[model samples]
Target: MRRIAGVFLAVASVLGAQPRKPIQDVRIDILSTMLTGNAGLGEWGFAAVVEADGRRILFDTGARPETVLRNAEELRIDLSGITDVILSHNHGDHTGGLLTLRRELGRRKQSAISKAYVGAGAFWQRSETSVLAAAKNAYESGGGTFTEVASAREIFPGAWLTGPVKRVHAEKNYGGTGKVRNAEGLWVEDNLPEDMSLVLETTKGLVVVAGCGHAGIVNILEQARREISKAPVHAAIGGWHLFAATDEHLDWTASKLKEFGVENFLGAHCTGIEAVYRIRQRAGLTRRTCATGAVGGGFTLKDGLRPGTLAK
Candidate 1:
């Protein structure tokens, strides 16, 4: 009887420890941006289409639905294929495309997207009523349902959200002046506690995609490292919000990211070109580590996440 129980326990353990499938490829297409290398589609916003593990995830939909839709048309990207949409924060550049995405979903007459992930404060009227209204209308008018992420959790086998990153570093500041309505029905300064990042686990490590690093890049990275695996981060793509940062801050950020084993830093939108350049010029970033993202360009990681020089 003891042996029988032991055997059953062993079988249960084996069944519980399912082997994780390796992600074959992770392709990220820059759908919209303020700085463009391909030209003709430049807009003051940020958006990208990420394809990984047979899942098409749209991260942040630029500043406006029209801009994103127009750019998507130019890039030949079908928004209908997006199975999930993740908004990093409640900022305009990130949430502006919600209405348009909803409209497009209506036009296609299909809800292919399993869900739209967002932080808890994503629907709050931080700056104005229009943004939150757009989000609500989009979701209610047959758009994919909005799943609010309050804590770190894996939405897919290899995909996750760094929900409400804990602020560890003292120097990291929440720089946005936006305001949100509090419980008392009075609008107050919004510290953007709902800022989050999308993390993808790959063979090499974690790839973090953020809308705007309002939670501070350092804090975001730390949360991602802790939530994902102990494996080193392969890349960090998106706005770092270092436009107003001082030289000391940029240097410190670069050093810390390197120490954390982040190899690639693709800065766009609010990252500030100068800050990215400084990061590239650092001691270890010689191999295509720093570059401004192009609007129509894409990045592909095949097989294991090996270190090959990424195309600039």
Candidate 2:
């Protein structure tokens, strides 16, 4: 009888150790612009904040923590209240602000928020091998915890960091250059990895917060559907990496997205102005342009969609 009781207790403990399902209320802050003052294109990055069952989770610190912090302050966002921080990839624009952010939180006397660095290990390789390596090292040295993502994991109830997206589509190469330094000094290239996105299950549908969509937007959407099993996509916001895409690629992507019935899209960063115009021309989809000063601009599952106010 005692053995039976012990066995039952052990089973209960095992079950208790399993992670609970995430609750869901997701919001993303477009902390900065990929295009700077001169309009030179840059890497895509944003800050994703999710409030699920009262817990606050931050995703992807932008290129400048100061910029993100300033926006947070203006929006009345309390960094001290954040519970978790998730970095989508290792690019400087995506993770440049983590150390500063940690310092800021420390200054406020708040315990360091738990952080999850989700991406392929490749992100930490050298720039000659991987363009995002430097930023990955910087983020790690800044007191952020790293979690290797193999499959979807719940960071909060109903909020998941979809693991590294698998490349399954034959999209155009859209060759472009990325800044890198080596024995020969700074250079550029067409090699970059397609990574994960933040997926939030809302009352209306799934809201996908992407980083760069290097994985192909269609692939990301299909994976999101696979993860949630037919959860209609309420909205998708983030860099779409469509700056150099051909007309056919853009058209095909738009067509595929329409078939999935995504309600809203807020494309920024690498999603070129041309792509934005084209997307807007498509019917039944609400589109918005996001940039640096628009940090506080975001959408809620309940609030529907809101664009950043145009700067004068």
Candidate 3:
């Protein structure tokens, strides 16, 4: 009996010591952005279909449902397969495609999106009833539900939502010109508390996906490190919201990102082309470090070219 107990303990220890298997590959199909390699479908928004671990996830919905759907058809991406939807923020540009996505699901008579993961502040619109009303309406229309993330939580085995990143660093740049409602129902300047990021733990490191990135880029990365995972950030794709950044702000951001040792970076949507150029030129970032994010561009991180290399 003593020997058997010892053997069971050994087996338990071995099983506990084994690390979880990392995700094999992540395929990002960009549906909308500022520019397009495919003709006629371009919008000033961001949305991507992420395929990994046998799950099809929609990162954002772009600025317009029509544009996103059109691009999805052109890319031959079956919207009926998306099981999860992660909304980075509550802006119309990011949530625009919910209605259209709902419509598509209704037409197919199939359940594509099961749940939409959103931040706490997602439903808090300045003066409006609720910015998330659109999302709620769509979900109800399709027999879906909304999962509000107040803190860091993992929706999947290795996928996490860096729930509400804290702005610990310098606040030189005033996020964006958006607002949220107060508890008393008054509109106040939005600090974008609902801004969250998606972190995918992989063999190499963490692959972070941001929408708008209203919570400074550095803050988002730091939150990922502090709250979610300790692994180094291997690659980051999405908007940084540096459209109105000054030369100094841009330089500082680039230098900080370099310090963080981020190997791959792809900025788009609100990251302003001029901001990208400045980061590459003055901030000492290489073209490879400062990747392209044209519309309708699909980026396959593993089993293909690195992030931002699939620019058309």
Candidate 4:
């Protein structure tokens, strides 16, 4: 019986020594962005379809009503199968196609988007000019639901939402001249408090996806570190909103990326081409690792990053 016990212990030791299986491939398909090469339309907006752990989530809408819809149809990507949608913030460029997406995609499949996940203060404004305010009413009345996440939480086993990232870095990215009233009837600068990002956990590392990075990419990463894991970031894909970043700011941003160990970077939308190049130089990222994000490009675990038009 001693030999039997020893054999069992050996097996247990080996089993314990084995590494945990990595999560399945999380495929990200960019449906809207500034650049497009696959005969698809390009616009000044952000929208992507993320397939992770057998769930499909539309990250954001687009600037115009037809941009995302036309691109999706052009790319031969079906949005009808997706039931979950995440609105990164309340900006028009990010939420302009909310109604169109739901209406068009829902026509094909009634359950195209059953629920929308948004930040807590996304619809804080009641003005008629507020796109989000209009969407909230129209959306809810159409039998759809919205869940406002205020803090970091795992929406699924391997997918997490870094809700309302804490601005822990010197990156106060937003500089728009807008204001909104809070629940207490106090008006404040619309610094996009509803800004957030999606963090996906995999065996390699965490993959952070952002809409506009208006909350500051560093802030998003810090929140992910606190809520998700402190592991090296495997990839960061989406709009960086650094169109007008100064040299000093870009250098600081690059340093932060290096500090977080970001391996792959896809800078899209307001993440100016020159900014991507500068950051690449400072962060020691190669063309293959750090490339501009386009309408027909994205990243996935199985095939790695599908670089954009300006990959070179």
Candidate 5:
């Protein structure tokens, strides 16, 4: 009987049969960001470790491979167990630490980064030399794997990746700059079609985690609600690439965020300090609900938020 019970528990873990806790119980630890953490260092990059639905996922590699490693050590976090990773886009700042994280962490745990997830076109040729090429090649050569996400799908029970967000709005988050191969295999103005975000579903609402948000925050939110879940947005975290927005754009974005039921925000990376403040004021959010993300900062269902700076 004991042997049978042990076997059942093992099977449950392997098959993800353990009854899920509330989505709010999931905690996200910001591993790298522009803002300072208690002990971790900052950089002009973004990376996080999301602990949700009993899975530990490395969201994005930071601008420098060693920066993440150094920060993680200072924060007393361990990456040896990260079996899955996600590349928000193909930019260097985001994909810098892929090889390092996989190699260093995998040394301790054989499956440190066995599988990676990315939006479609992450590997498409760019007019300029793509930074993601070398790292991805090295990773694949070492038997690492990748999954190109094209549409919205729940990668885990409660975690969904908004694959290739639809640009129904005029935001033009990327300003249609750069050059990337489009469907016809022609290089065109790169709107970063592969830019995507992570959506966490909770009983209260959804938590959207954007990486650069080249797809436009409004578009990501609307699409998440349209295709992923009807639940209201509880929080907007991570990078949104709003550092260059004009006052008019910020105003519209703030109003739209309020309309989308975004009650909390922890803007980091390309989300400039001024932008966060303007958005907070325009959206009528209190300091408790809006703050600036940092290296060691994070958010959870219970504690709400731990940010480096708060909206005044």
Candidate 6:
């Protein structure tokens, strides 16, 4: 019965192709300070390093290449060791230092090469006004490879980039001084262009690394669950874009995340103090500050929380 055998094989293939269960051994390194200048007020940028299956993937080069480089040097994070670089979105603060980083890594002896990953629309999103175009051009000119994805894709085994999360919640009224304006002189609404987040299938649960959460942290979490089938969110570290969030918005986000069993949260950069406090007040959350000048100040997926060692 060749026909019957073919049907059975097709069904097996469909089930096997489903997204695999959770993954483990994911680590995120905060390479730069959360705030650029002062303790509370400063431009925000973050560098996230993800380690999965013995490969190093860098996500988002901070606002300043020097800062990222210096932090990497101090942390002993070898830039030459990085294999992939993922830009979350096309903002200057996220991609400003990419050029410098590429140059530095290219000079290494081992020549640990890096490929740039981003959303397809990132290139055409008002490139003149945004630094994304510059970053892309620099990487391409440097002989580095580039890849574009329209939606979530698995970059490594059990490691996924949740591309362009759909904003399901009603838009919240939030404004800030660092808002980006388009060529029309209008503040771009939260049309986050396929903002990506890293999802690591951990033995404990899923570890989510967010750049700015412009795609909405709740949306990221929901998509992660749908992708991996409700695996516990072990930890979420990076900018939450909560500085401008209303109290109601903050409360709702906190309530929603609580149900997902997020155990550790390292709030930094755009996550306002008030929002951090709200998240800390919730049960099962341990808060750690990820400010600038905080060398050796990162958490490990295997070792758990690590406090900020920045000098006062």
User: Whole-model Cα lDDT per candidate?
Assistant: 0.74, 0.64, 0.75, 0.85, 0.86, 0.68
How badly does each model clash, as a count of residue pairs? 0, 6, 1, 0, 0, 6
Rate residue 68 of model 4 by lDDT. 87
Candidate 5 lDDT, 83-131, residue by residue in tens: 8888899888888988888888888888887688999988888876767
Q: What digit string (tens of lDDT, one per residue) describes model 3 on residues 112-166?
A: 6667888887877564444456568757766878888989998887888998877
Output the lDDT of residue 298, model 4.
93
Looking at model 1, residue 85 earns an lDDT score of 80
lDDT of 2 by residue, 43-120 (tens): 345665656557777777777657667666666677776746777666666666677777787567455554655665
Model 4 TM-score is 0.90
Error of 6 at 112 (Å): 3.8
Displacement of residue 306 (Cα, Å) in model 2 is 1.1
The TM-score measured for candidate 3 stands at 0.87
User: What is the descending lDDT order?
Assistant: 5, 4, 3, 1, 6, 2
Ranking by TM-score: 5, 4, 1, 3, 6, 2
Task: State the weakest 10-residue window (summed lDDT) of model 3.
Answer: 303-312
lDDT of 4 by residue, 1-312 (tens): 999998998998887755544567788988888987665788988999998877889999988988988888888888899888899988888889888888888898887776889987888873326677777888887768999999887787778898887777768788667887776888877778888899988877999999999998888887898778888899999998888899999999999999999998989887888998999999999888888888878998776788665563
Candidate 1: where are CA atoms >4 Å away?
1-15, 112-114, 124-130, 171-174, 181-188, 303-311
Query: Model 2 scores what on Cα lDDT?
Result: 0.64
Per-residue accuracy of model 6 over 1-312 as CA lDDT, tens digit each: 999998998998888865565555665667754543222223468676777757788888888756676667666778787768888877777887787887877788324446888865565544246777766666776787778777778887778888767677744322333443544656565365557788887778888887777777888889888865478887777777877877777778777878888887776667666777776675335444222223345567677655454421
lDDT of 1 by residue, 39-137 (tens): 337676778888887788888888876777777787777878666888787767777877777676657747654367878766665565546445675
User: Would you estimate the TM-scores of all the predictions?
Assistant: 0.87, 0.77, 0.87, 0.90, 0.91, 0.82
Which residue pairs show backbone clashes in model 1? Answer: none
Clashing pairs in 2: 22-156, 22-157, 22-158, 23-157, 23-158, 33-292
Q: Candidate 4 has which clashing residue pairs, if any?
A: none
Name model 5 segments beyond 4 Å from true: 1-22, 175-177, 309-312
Give the per-residue Cα lDDT of candidate 4 at 311: 64
